[model samples]
Target: MDYVIEAPLVCVCDLDGTLLRSDATLSGFARDGLNRLINAGVHVTVASGRSLQAMRALLNGVELGLPVIGLNGALISELDTGRHLLIRALESTPARAAVAILAAHGASPLITSWDGTQDRVHHVKTMNAASDWWVAEKREYGDPRLRLSEDLEGVAGQEDVVLITGFVPDQAAERLLEQLRAELAGAAIIHAGQHIYCTGWTEFQIQHPQADKGHAVPHLLELTGLRGSTVLACGDHLNDLGMFAAADESIAPANAHASVLAAATATAASNDEDGVIHWLLRRARLIGAS
Candidate 1:
């Protein structure tokens, strides 16, 4: 599909393997280039598995012209005011069932929920090395929502449970994914596969049935009065497939997973090469060194 520059346009981007480098950091070149796109009247926003606060930390200096899709599209929050535009929270029954299934399969989840005003993340002490590393990384990032929980199952019964995520070995992940699908059925939305940054480890995320980038994109278009706009999306993992399907055009980084590359309408340089912003700049017809 051809994108007309003159028409209203929206660019929804993924963070991990699509925008941020392997070290989970954003480069100056990307930051500047993204700001330029926003300045030049391209409606830019992010769709990420990261929480809103974490996303903000990574995008500290950049301006997002629209609400961001967070928690793998379970949450959508306004950029400047921090207001929630939409939240597809998982119900308590399904949440508890999912937690129990994960535990039975030898995985403990980091549970995330919204309490109207802010996020509350409940985590067990540690189930494995990967879980320990995940907690440490969040601490290093200054994640304020981290709450030590002795009863993760109880936390899952909360009213607004948004995300249940964890990491496991690739082999275990496959089994766990199969079980969750067979058991949970239509109760939750599940995304599981190899981690984009942490090799040998697979990440599993469970959320509300309507929660995924594809569903969030249409809501965002309506909220921003851009439903008629040409929508372009960028992503780099299995979780990104939903957004890719929803977008008019989808761009995947060269380093993206094989499935992601195959699904994309076009490809760009790898994340280390600052691909996303470069692609946007060229598509927007903006002049800048890539």
Candidate 2:
């Protein structure tokens, strides 16, 4: 079969249900395809709502040389070197106000921060339960940095806070988001995803107005000496929208949310079918190779 080898195509991908199948595992075809892409000098980066620490654990066995866009673009870190490229954090004043609003609505927020080195600090109220991501964090980090807040007012003013997140039921989350948009006019409100639906709220992240994965993609490309037109991005959620819209070519798996699928230039096989590998093979013209 004829082949087309494109060198150094920059591919930014999402986790969860994109690269990793819905079962939270990487299929062999996907694994081999990713390895092939890396061997061909493609720059593959993980861009997701996951924290840097969590992403590191999930990608531990994969050998990809690229930085990660984490926390919906609030944090960026080099995958191989563990170097922090940039971190856009919420300013204390707005962060505190956000927390107060959530608290009043009977929801608890998860506050995230980074120490000077490899540690992450997460503060949550006593009543809050663990999230799948949070559980993964604890298992990997061995006592992932955590603190209890009688009230988040104490840590609200701390410097270097990157994100303030909370689990809300769908309806309440929707209502709180409406209020937040009005009250915290300059802040960015994102619904990362839902673990379960409670009263209509879902998992959400509150970030600095400027912190968004979409905004981070261009910045990361600049750092890597690449251009927007040279990049291809794949994602499955609203948080992925920013980068999705900004990429030269955008792709989504068949199972992607309607909004996400609508933004992509093409749709690939579902993650269960090793969609990433399937798409990459076609893009590189490697399919049907003997």
Candidate 3:
């Protein structure tokens, strides 16, 4: 059932650990509720660390009414049309430094970039079990972005460096995070923590300094012509902090990271319980009531 909701509003939701369950699947309840929101004239969109291609795959059946924030804000694109609304990349100098640093640790980091067209992920042969598994999974999806490179460093040093990512052993990931933070201080935005899918491994991602969800949300609002709309942002991770700061209201799932929960304006049920969709429905009800 659809009800009239006359408010000019927009909702920006994070994918992993918020909209999706622990197993990375969107529940039927959540999927239906999302469509209900769209039917009610709510401008709904997503902000995710996933690439545009991956996001499209994950949200295959959903109708996205606005451009999605992808690659942790390095990209904002229309999922249906595959049109880039905004794209940001790291400087070649710092990008090279990052590639060298990760390679020294024997991490064959995958460099993601765009050539004014489709996204490309460049990598050398896997150097470890974790990276090998990651590559295999990408292959399982038949991800078109995978670009095997003879010289990973050379690829990273080129123009349009969107993201540099790799997986390392748990303890080494922590150490490397600290080292990269210190060495590349302010030159890049570095995120390192437990890899969502790969057990016992830490995933690290390096992106341009300005490429973050917080910086991208405002641009999204303006581009969609919803700049004055009441914006509600939701997430369940540290990367969502910038987005939280930029939003009029912030929400988190019950299972969200401690930091994210503390920063949230409100809390909803765990992702497993379809927290995001529940929260959206409840909010719509309240708006309709008023």
Candidate 4:
């Protein structure tokens, strides 16, 4: 006997190194392809490590109104309003502890929070030169949530922080990861990527245990009334694993990280080659999107 599935299909995509090219911009082919997908009754949206504001900034002119997953799944919200569909925040105690650990080791971590209505980011304790460069870069993009402080003291008092990120030399990042694992047991410690900051070879992000793309994507599917339907998720990094885990079909660019490539159901072209667009068009055709 054969089974027939009735739920609608939804396509969830990652931003960096997946949909967006190496320069952090979307290609014309991708934009047109996604717009066409949306027009064909296929739900299209972004699930990114970027904050809500950053997402809008980077995706400018794309003409999309769907919800987005932000801050590595700490936030799921409307792209325009930043209203949270589902949120998981790091408690004040842990947020402070995370800050303390990074500060003690001369690492100035960037703190992010989603308090339902808006997204806020806090940076504390005398930033290093590289940290300053990162701040300047984001400022050029009109990042409004970036709050600078002399120290972590009295920032967002009593309010929960959702994500904490830091950058350090590859070796130091490794050590920090070990230290964080031991100090912040049960906390999500992720070595996000490498060569991200001007002075560092690795970037690490810490978040609430439930702040994961896997959980967030499923929640979105449920909200869209597509529960149990075939979900096509795409990405090129470890942060994308959560979404991959929740997807029935997962796609990774040819240049994806080793781990991601291994887990992907199939490989698409490299982002520079517009592999995501190719996959989407092919998928839409297969599903008879006309």
* lDDT on C-alpha atoms for all candidate structures: 0.86, 0.73, 0.86, 0.77
For model 4 the local lDDT of residue 27 reads 91
Which segments of model 3 are wrong by more than 4 Å?
Answer: 286-290
- For candidate 1, what's the RMSD? 2.7
State the lDDT of candidate 3 residue by residue for 1-290, as single tens digits: 45657786789999999999999988887887787788788888999998887888888788888999999999999999878889889988888889888888766788889866678988786567777776776787789888888687687666589999878888788678888988899999999878777888888899999999999999998898888889899999999999999998899999999999999999999999988789888887733321
Q: Give the TM-score comparing model 2 with the true structure, all chains together.
A: 0.88
Q: Return whichever of 1 and 4 wins on TM-score.
A: 1
Q: Per-residue alpha-carbon lDDT of model 4 for 220-288, expressed as tens digits?
A: 877767777778999999989878989989999998999999999999999999897788777766342
lDDT per residue (tens digit) for residues 1-290 in model 2:
34446555888898877888776667766777777777666777888877766677677667777778987888788766657789888777888888888777766766777655654555553544433355444555655556555557567675467777777666566687788788888665555456532333477678887688789998888887777437888887777888888888888999888998999998988877778667876786665522
- Candidate that scores best on TM-score: 3
> lDDT, candidate 2, residue 265?
95
Candidate 1 structure lDDT: 0.86
For 1-290, candidate 1 gives per-residue lDDT tens digits of 22335666799999998899988999999998888888878999999998887888899999887999998889889866668899999888889988888878767688888876778888887576666777777899898988999888887875489999878889788788888899889999998877666678888899999899999999999888889788999999888999999999999999999999999999999999988778888888776535
Winner by lDDT between candidate 2 and candidate 1 = 1
| TM-score list, all predictions | 0.94, 0.88, 0.95, 0.90
Worst-scoring 10-residue span by lDDT in model 1: 1-10
Model 2 weakest 10-residue run by lDDT: 192-201
